[model samples]
Target: MAESIPSDSPAVADDHHGHEEPSFWSKYVFSTDHKMIAMQYMFTGMAMAVIGGFMAYAFRMQLAFPGIEVPGFGIVTPANYNALVTNHGAIMIFWVAMPVLIAAFGNYLIPLMCGCDDMVFPKLNRLSYQIFLLSAVVLLSSFFVEGGGFGGAWTAYPPLSAKAEYSLTPLGSSIWLGAVALEFVAFLLGGINFITTAMNSRAPGMKLYDIPIVIWMIVIASILFLVSVGPLIAGAIMLLFDQQLGTAFFDPARGGDPVLWQHLFWFFGHPEVYVVLLPALGITAEIITVFARKKLFGYKTVLHTTIATGVLSFTVWAHHQFISGVDPRMAHVFTLTTLLISVPIAEMMFVYIATLYGGSIRLTTPMLWGLSFIAEFLIGGVTGIFLGASGADIYFHDTYFVLAHFHYTFFPIAIIGTFAGLTFWFPKMFGRMMNDRLGKIHFWGTIIPFNFIFIPLFVLGMGGQHRRIFDYSYFPELSMPWMQDIRVLATSSLLIMLGFQVVFFYNFIVSLRSGEKASKNPWKSNTLEWTADSPPPHGNWKELPTVYRGPYEYSVPGRDEDYWPQDQPN
Candidate 1:
């Protein structure tokens, strides 16, 4: 049974509990609270995931069994494959991962963990979400427009994307350009909010050192988005001008270089991967500390490594353009920077694994996701080394090997890390604990099938199959019996992977209403948010927590409990 406090209690006051109920607009439509904004991001991201996943499946079907007609959905054509690939990349990266990891988790967790009442600028946060929603609507609406959405690619490479003559749809390319601009603006707004809130809103005594690793990652990611996104925004504007205003920024025939677009795009693109990885890194830090029953080892080293990773991310953008006929000298430079990136990443990984040495390990759902992240991310990161080598990249650049490597990296962060954050914070988010049994089922099912889906993709790449092709069976080089057998197996694994998500969906929705009530500090960790109410009030903490130490001070020798909240005075 749960105990209740009076409305006039100091706890209520400290938590900013004045309103009995919000009116129509405040409650849902234009909520200013960080938590509500996070929920809005989650729902929107999930919707985009469905759209992106369906697009992937559609393309996959065409690749495995070409010219096969299924009920309700019509035949998948070559042009349709192009469209699916474009929309899939755009939706997954920009809409699903960016919004879910950075916007949603960053917004919700930052204020709560830092002991702040709201984002530094609440109304601005609301506006950012609305703008993102508007951007998604505009993007989806493009599919219904003349010639459908932009089919060139999500990167919208020039010559391909700059001319209406080269594009399949006149309106599709324009809408793609416009929709992306809107989404960029949305992120810009969000980036400002994240940086400002992290810097300005931390509770008294909560120095930068005392903040949680998750906040640090988010703050760094925000800075990355701020500095890195500007070039892409400039490039997007130039591409739009070339497409619409008779300019020649990327139109080679009109005195522009097609390769220039790749430079501008990948300049932002590689850092974008770190933008996704950082939040996952933050969640990993939090979970590893709690589950290991120990403080994070080499905390400052991990922080500096993340900062170094961000700085090095800018220097390695040309690696993606190695085959695009850019300066060969630049390739060696990029190769060095790209490989150097792994050192910092490896340092961080070693820290997590070292933290787990000889500690009490509880195989909770969040910890399971964290451990799985290490395994899956390692496979992804190690394989990335293969691509970083210009010699090896020559054969594998556009091959399924590259696809497998990135998918390995992305799935763990986007799927596993997101699930880890969800499982770890579900109690605080919803005021109820998710069913442990159901959570375990969701975890194992996903981890097994996820590996199944991508591991064979490596084989496909090794067999000389290229990515973005509609049909594998059409090419005799790829039509060998062994290749065909593996294609079928891989396709089956993908379907199983798709089915496994249903268990997660069921657990998430059902547990919201019926799961066990959670304690305020369910995980017994030394984070500020845990010191507050279970489902923290509008402001967050009852009395604003005055931090006394770093966030990961678990198992301190003299402490009565294994962990201590940051707010507890000596």
Candidate 2:
């Protein structure tokens, strides 16, 4: 149950009653505090990112310099190369990106932004992380199983993934399926808490519109995840039964349908894109409005468009099925909806651009990342049109063009957008300022090399370079000696971008102990969380903040200060 704040206490003051301070274990580990849990998610996700990043490095090294001995892994074999590719895609999406972007901020920000003490189901929230941690362990263990890690692509398409006889790695495949299933369970539990907290536990007198757009996005995303994940979970279970117990749900020899698995996987898979994307969009929206010193343009329209996008996401999963032997007529339907889905996204992007027009812009570290997300995601969204159309997709189907498009989308949202939120809320999270100068340096280092790495993939893709091929030198048709330079270039850009993150991590850690102490509401933005202590107390507020207006009030005429906090009396 949500705690009731006493009537007489102010929002910012502490110490209504005396209580002993908890030990480190109780306060930090095994705690139900949302902020602590969020921190746990961030660190754990970063650890997973290290694992995922290494996999990408190994495979990229293999492609750029085939059979070269890496320091730890030795010369990358064909089987080993496949593992790196499969685990890189799987770990980055499921373990690193989703947990960091969705579960991390969803736990940390939802209650605070919605004006609550902690999640309504605090124990369930804690268990979700514990389960997620176990899932990570299980996934890592698959690397050691019999024939090496399962590598039927991240899509895990069957007959290849379904039959151990065909895939030739029985135990690893089964465990991978199990890990993915466990992850789904963890998020499902977390998603329920998000929706319930936003709906039932909002601070009194705060109407739906008074809620921050970030909170709205998280709630809607949770709903989409909950509704969409069911089929995939069912699909995974059936696949597991086939692999371990020989049920043959996807094996055609046993009268099962391989295309059925694609439908199930992609049904959840398409909305799953927004599951990872919308919260980052929420973070960028908040940062942009604050830095630009303006109200969010078309707040109601943005809200409605968000819901529309969620609905539209469901209809376009079959776009992935166009070349997969589906009915061409049905292909036309999916293509139409896939292209149409971009309209709402384009509207939201233009709104951000319009919000920045003639406003007092702060070129802060966070704003740079927010702007990078817009710029990068625009490229991603535009390129997706080519793949959305059946005619164009048949040419670009499994090429690096698709790879470039998705990396543009997921990297910006998960990496760039997450960076923005991390920097913008660093003070709020830690009660200290991150070094703004170092942050700007880190931002440039990441964005420039990121573009260098992925943009050339478009050219290589246009040159008919296919994805997941370990060596291209064997083929005479692809044997342009100069084309290998593109592979080397992308690999070099990856290493450089990774080097910058060391600076980011250093700034994040050092600033915690030695940086400038923050005042309450450092950004002076209009949000209830800003009404509390910088690192809010265990229960977040001494008294709940009563709402007065929307969260984006800025630059109004006759206001002495440009900002008006949401807790201030109107």
Q: Clash totals for all models, in order?
A: 1, 0
Tell me the tens digit of each residue's lDDT in model 2 across 161-201: 98888888888888999999999999998998888889988
- Candidate 2's clash total is 0
- Give TM per candidate: 0.95, 0.96
Clashing pairs in model 1?
14-542
lDDT score for residue 90 of model 1: 89
Cα lDDT tens digits, model 1, 47-84, are: 99988988877777766677887334579877777888
- Kindly provide the TM-score of model 2 when superposed on the true structure, using C-alpha atoms: 0.96
